[model samples]
Target: MASVTENKPSNPWQVWRPGIDPAADALERVSVLINRHEHITAGYAFTLGESARRYAEQCSLGFLLGLEMVVREHGNQAAILGWRHAASTVPQPSKSQNEGEKDA
Candidate 1:
């Protein structure tokens, strides 16, 4: 039982949205924001920006955003899981850094 609990994978969806109630009320709100972002960025399909495209694709993978937010909110188990999922997105994170590429 201990091993089973220890092996449970951290999930980003399980992370609570700060200031938002983690209940049925938040789902549609989140979905609306997500859909709005998707619609607004759909024009990117026609744009010829390679770097922007790569950045968007990396964000699409999700772990980086989840990691950054959870890290910013102080800490969470999902943040730890994000690190485990981030090896492929190293160069990606370097670019996403707000301060500098120091962590790169």
Candidate 2:
């Protein structure tokens, strides 16, 4: 007998910004740093150095993801705040037109 299963739509892991690929850039920079560090530790024989490298990579990944989230949140907040301030200061069109009229 064959069984049927329900499929769910795939969700995006990160919100993308126009003209910027944060994940790709983060991964690329991390790869470069790992390679450079590996080259410098080429003569090391202890697991301590390897462990430290692993920890650093994990920390870098976390930091990059957190930074992206913070930036998105802050950008949204700033836009909303600006809009609120602008709305409050805007004068009604009728009020402006009436201000220049004088009784005949």
Candidate 3:
């Protein structure tokens, strides 16, 4: 006798958002700093330092993936997507963090 197994769909993995994850926040912060100091626009290549090149590539990957998720979730209308995406999901920072200092 052959046995049959039922198939169940798995939940789709969500792309991590900055406001919802500390790691995501760190990634976003570094990404922003890299862009600002390097004076490169989003999705642009960095032709200077090795660190700059690597960080730029990493930032672009995260940005593209996040944009893809946002587009898929919200369709073409992007006027309010930034606000919606930034809506708080993660808990507020602790007292130490709120005091403008991060624990080492």
Global lDDT for candidate 3? 0.38
Model 3, span 12-66: residue lDDT tens: 2344543454434434444443445445433321222222223233345666456
Deviation of model 2 at 72, angstroms: 24
Compute the lDDT for candidate 1.
0.37
**What overall lDDT goes with each candidate model?**
0.37, 0.38, 0.38
Error of 1 at 76 (Å): 34
lDDT by residue for model 2 over 4-59, one digit each (tens)? 43264444434433225534444333343344544433223122222222333334
**Candidate 3 segments whose C-alpha is farther than 4 A from its true place:** 1-16, 38-104
Misplaced by over 4 Å in model 2 are: 1-19, 38-104
Best by TM-score, which number? 3
Ten-residue stretch with the least lDDT total in model 3: 44-53
Q: Residue 28 lDDT in model 2?
A: 38
Clashing pairs in 2: none
